[model samples]
Target: MSCIPLTQKSSDFLISSLSQVNPFNDTSSIIKWIEYKNNQRFEVNKIPLSKIENWYFEETTGNLRHQSGKFFSIEGIRVETNAGPIKQWSQPIINQPEIGVLGILTKKFNGILYFLMQAKMEPGNINKVQLSPTVQATKSNYSRVHKGKVTKYLEYFLDKSKSWVLLDQLQSEQGGRFLRKRNRNIIIEVPSNEDVPVYEDYCWLTLGQIKNLLQYDNIVNMDTRTVISCIYYNCNGNDRYDIDRVNECIHYSPLIEDSPSGYYLDILKSAMKKDEGLSGMDDIRSWSTNLKTKYYLDVNSIPLREVEKWRHDEFNIYHEDGTFFRVIGASIDTDKREVGSWCQPLIEQIESGVVGFITKKINGILHFLVQAKVEPGNFDILEMAPTVQCITGSYKNEKPENQPKYLDLFLNPDQSVVRYHALQSEEGGRFYKEQNDYWIIEAGDEFPVEQPENFVWMTLGQITEFVKHNNYVNVEARSLISCIGLI
Candidate 1:
C-alpha cells in the first residue's frame, strides 16, 4: 500500500470521528471487556529496593540498575533553571535513554476507519487494565532482552513493508520524573483486504467509539491518548493536500447526524479554522524560539548518594518534605504480560496534581491558553505546556503570587464554564498509581485576551500542528487534548 495523502487522511478522520458504530464491538461491550480483563490473574506487591532480584546499586554512584544493564535506571541529577522561583534542586530521575514505540493500527471497514486497541495490563495501573495502543513496547521488551514472548504486531511498526505510516513523530514524556525521555508516537493503516489477526484481548473500534470512551475516566491509557492526540483534522493550503474537497466528500453525509452539537461543535469549528487563531503559526514559533533563547537551564548527572536534601533508605529514596515523588521497588506477578513476573523500580507520586487548559474565544474562534515551560529534563529546555500544570499539594502553603499562573481559575471555577473534567492516570508501566485532575475550563466573556510573557493563546488546530513535530508540546497537554469530546 502506498502512503495515504494528508487530505484523504483528514477526510477519513472526520468520517470516523462522526461514526460510533462499527462491525466489531460497541462502547458498552468495550467497557465490559476491560472490566473482565481487570479480573484476570495479576499480582503486584511492594518490595524493598534492596531486595529486588537481578538489580543492584553501584558501589561508587549508588545508582540502581538491572543486572544486564539493558533497561532503565534510577539516578540523581542536579537542576538549575531561571524560570521558576527555586533556582536549584536535586532529585532522582528515571534515565531511560532508549526511545520506545507507542503505535496504533488502523483498517478501513465499510469505508470507515476502525482502530485496533488492546486491553493491556500494566504493573502500576490503579484499575489494573485500560485500553492502550496496539503496540506499546520498550526496546528491551521488543528485543527480548528478558527472553520472553515476542511483542505481537511490532513488525508493522519496525518494517515499512508491512504497513503505510499515517502519522509519526517523536514525543516527550513527563519532564519532572523522566530525564530526556521520549517515545515514537505513530499510527499506520493496513490494506483493507489484509487478514490481520485480532488477539482475544484486542478489538476494533471506530474513532468515535474511542472518543466516547475518553469521556469516561481512566478507560483509555496514556499511550493511547498521546497517539490519538496526533490525529489531525485541518488542511492548510497545499497543492498536494486540499481541505475543501475533503470536506465536500463527507460534508452532508448522514454519518454526522449524531455528531456533537453544543460546546463540542464549537471545538470542531475551532479545530477546522486554522487561519482565524489569535496568533499565526509563525508568531507562535517565534515566541517559542525566543523563550528557548531567553531561558537558562543547566543540568548535570550526579551520584544518587550526593543528591542533597533527599534520604536514601533501604526500602525507598525520598525527599525530606515528601511532596514531589519517590523511587521504590515493586515485585509484579502476572501471566497477561510479555514476561510472566519481574522485579523493577518504579516512581510513585506522593501528591495529586492538576493539569488543565483555559480556553476562550478569540475572533470568534476557540483558543487555548498555553505556557512555554522550561524543565531540566526537556530535550529542548522549553515546550508548550498547559495553562496550569503543577502538584496542588506542593503549593498549599505557597503564596498566591508564587503559584502557577491561572491555577486559581480551575480551583474556583463556575459550573457553567467547565467544559471537560476528569481524573486521568499517567503511564502505568512506569508510574505507580499516579493520577491527575485533568480539566478544560472555558473562560468567561470577562476573561482578558492579554497573558503573561511566558504564555500565549492557540487553537486546537494550531496545537495539533505543533504536536506533529518533536518536543513542542508536553505530554500533560497531549493527555488533556486526547479527552476532547467530539460526540
Candidate 2:
C-alpha cells in the first residue's frame, strides 16, 4: 500500500525473522529432499518419434494438425486467431483437463496470524525451490502413483467438518498460454493452540516476514504471492480507517508507519476485496462486465514471421536474434496428472526478464507511469502495461528501437527508488522453464517526467479503479500491483 523506505526497526525484524529459519534461506536442500521422495517410483521418459503412436504430422509441413484419444480428441487452434475454427499446432495439447490445488494453511498465534509455508521444489523453477503453499497439489500430487497417500495436512483443508476455511475460489490459467489448467485456491485457519505438523522443509512465517521475502527474486513462488495478494484487510469486516486502527495492523506488516497515505491506502485496501476471493484474470463479474463495456480481445493470428516488429526462426520468435525468447516444444509426462501430461510448444525466454513500474508523486498525488503495449498473446489489442517489461539485455541490444522505456531508472537506482526488488515470475508450466524479474521503482515529487503518446501517469486510486476492469492493466503490470508490491 506504501512505497516508503523500511525503518531501522522494520529492517532488523525482517533480518532476524529470516535468520530464525536459516535452512530455508537457499532451497537447494529442500529441492533435493523433494526429488529424493519423488524418484522412488515416478519417472519421465523422453519418447522418440518412433515410439509415439496415434499421432501423425501433415506431410506438407511436418506439423501435428490434429490428434485424438480412444474416447475423445479436440482440435486446437492458435489462441490469437479469432476467426478460425480450432486448428492444431506443432506441439500436442493435453487431452485431459489438469487440476491444480493451492492451499494456504494459517493459524493465529498470540493474537497474530502466521502462515505455514514449505520450501517447495518445482521442475520449472529458476531457483530450484521457493516458499510455496503448505499444500500445492496438482493432479499428479493425489494420483494413483502416490497410492492414496493424502498430501500432508491436505485432509484438514478438504475436511469441512475439521477446519475453518477463510477463502476459496476457482481461478483460470492463461488460456492463450497454458493448456486447459485450473486451480482451486484455498485458505484455512486452524486453532491457535492446536498442534499442527511441521516438517523439516517447512516453517511458520508472519505476513511481515512473508513481505520481506518478496524483496528477493524467486524466493517466494508465484502461487504463494498470488494467494497472499488475495488476502485483504477489508475482508475482516471491521473496515475502519482511524489512525489507531492502522497502528494496530502494523504488527501484520514490518513496514511500520502511521498516518501515511491514510485515507487512500484504506480505499485501496477495500477496493481489492471480493466476496469471491482470489483470482487470476477476470473473475470479478463486475470487473469483467465493465471491461467489456468498451473493448475485448479481437484476436487474429498471422504467421510468426509476419507479426510486425518481430523476427522468428524456424524454432523461435524473437525481438532480435533470440534475445528475448525461443519457441520450443516438449513431450511432458507427469503420469499422475489428470491427462497424465502431454507435449506442447511453449515460450522459453532467452534469459530471465524483468517487469517494472516507476512511480512518482507529482503535485501531491502518486502517479504511475504506464505504457500502452501490444503483445502477441495479449487479450486486448493494447493495454496499460508496465513502463519497462523486457529481458535484461533487451535495452542493451543492437536493435535501437527495441529498447525498453524507463529501463535506466530500474537498472541504475539512485535516491529515486524508495523500494525495488527483482521478484520471481510464475511457474514454467506454460513458460517452459522460465522466470521473470519484477521491479517497482518509486520516485517522489523530485523525479521529472516526459509523457509520450502511448504513455500516461495515473494515481493509485485511478489505477485501482482500472484494475477492477480486465486487460486494462496487463499481467506484468497487474501482478506487480496485485501483490503487496505496489506504491
Candidate 3:
C-alpha cells in the first residue's frame, strides 16, 4: 500500500497532537474516566452515586426478575445445510428495525484532525471498560435517552448544527452466525471554532496517535479500526514515485521508515501496474448481497427445521448438544456510565477457536495462503476466508483426500515462520464472550503451495487494497491484518 498522501505540515500536526494525558487535569470532576478510575476509587472520602440498598441484581429467563423486559427469551436455530442440520443459538436481533449508527465524532484543531473516543463499557467485554465509539447508540438508545434531554452535543451529528460527513458505507457485523447485523458508519467533522463541550468520558486523539496505539494489542478497539479503515487517503495523482520526498518523509514523520516504507512503496507502484483495481464500491455491495443469494440459487442443502438439540422452557432455554455457547443472565450497575443501570444476557464460549494464515513470498512480493469458506450466512455460498479457521484440536474430519489444506503447518508452527500469535476476541457485544487464538503462519519454496479448486495466493498489497473496497477479506482476516505493525 502506497502512503495515503499526507503533506509534511499535516504529518507534523498529527505527530504533535499525540501528547500524553495529564493525570492532574480536571481532578475535581465527579464522573470518572476509566483512565483515572483507580485513582478516583482509592479516594477514601469520595461520594457515591447511589445508596447501596437501591442497587441489586437478579436472574430471569423468559421472564427474569429485576431484568430489562426488552430482551427476554433465548432459542435455538436449526439450519439445514449441505453438511447437516446445524443447531445454533438464536436470540432477539436488533430491537428496532431502523439501522443503528456506530459513528465517530471528529473535529479539526490547528490544522490537525482529532477523533472523539469514549471510555465505554459493554456487558461482555473482557475488560470492564475499553475505548469505544463517540456515538455507539442504537436506534433505541437514541429515542430513549438522547431524543429530548441529556444528549447535548448529539444534535450536531444527528440533524441540527451542520457539519456531519458520513462516508461510503454499509459495514456489517460478522454475521452473528444464525443472526444478521449491520450499522451505519459515520465520519463527521464539526467546525474548529465551535465550542463543543468535551464530556467526562470522552477524549480527543489524532490519526498518528491512533496508529501508534495500534502497535500495542487491543489498545485501539475493533470498532475504531473498522471505521478508520474506511478512510480513503489515497488521493495523490502524480502516478510516479518521488524518491526525494520519500527520504524527506523519513526524517520527521511519525510512522514512515526508510528501509521498508520506501521499499514497499516501490513494490506497490510496480505491482499496481500489473493489477486491475476494483471498479469501486458497486462491485463490493453486489458481492456481499448476492453471495448467499447466489448460493441458494445454485446448490440445494438440507432444509431448516426446529429440532430437539435445544430445549426451550416457558421462560428459559437449554441446549442438549452443547458444543457452541452458553447464556447467563446478569444485572449491571455503574455510576459513571450513560445507562447506569440495566439487565442483559451475556454469551460465554464453551471452547476456544483458532484463526491462522499461511504466507510466503511469491515473485519477490508477499503472498498469503487463502481459503474459500462457505458459511450458512454468506451472501455468496462461499467467500474468501482465512487460511486456517477451525475449532481448536479438531481438523481430522477430512476424508483422507479432502482434509483442510494446510492443517499440519498450522498445528506445528515454527517460531521463525509465525508473525503473530495471540488470542483475539469475537464481537463482545453480540457474541457470548468468546475468543479465538489467532496465528499468522508462514511457508516457503521448500514447502510447496497448492491451488485447490477454490484457493489462490495473492500479494499482500492486493489483499489490503481489496479490503478497502469490499468484503473480499472477511472480518477474521482483517483482525489478523490489524495486528500487523507494518503500515
> What is the TM-score of each predicted model, taking all chains together?
0.97, 0.62, 0.69
Estimate the overall C-alpha local distance difference test score of candidate 2.
0.52
Task: Give the Cα lDDT of each candidate.
Answer: 0.87, 0.52, 0.50
RMSD, candidate 3, Å = 7.8
Residues 179-263 of candidate 2 have per-residue lDDT tens digits of 4444666767777777998876677776555665676556777777646544434322332323343444444454333222443
Displacement of the residue 209 alpha carbon in candidate 2, Å: 1.8
Between candidates 1 and 2, the one scoring higher on lDDT is 1
lDDT of 1 by residue, 346-452 (tens): 88898779999999988877899999988888999899999999989888788888889888888878978898888888999889888888899998789999988
Weakest ten-residue segment in model 3 by summed lDDT:
41-50
RMSD of each: 1.9, 9.0, 7.8
Model 1: lDDT of residue 240: 26
Candidate 1 lDDT: 0.87
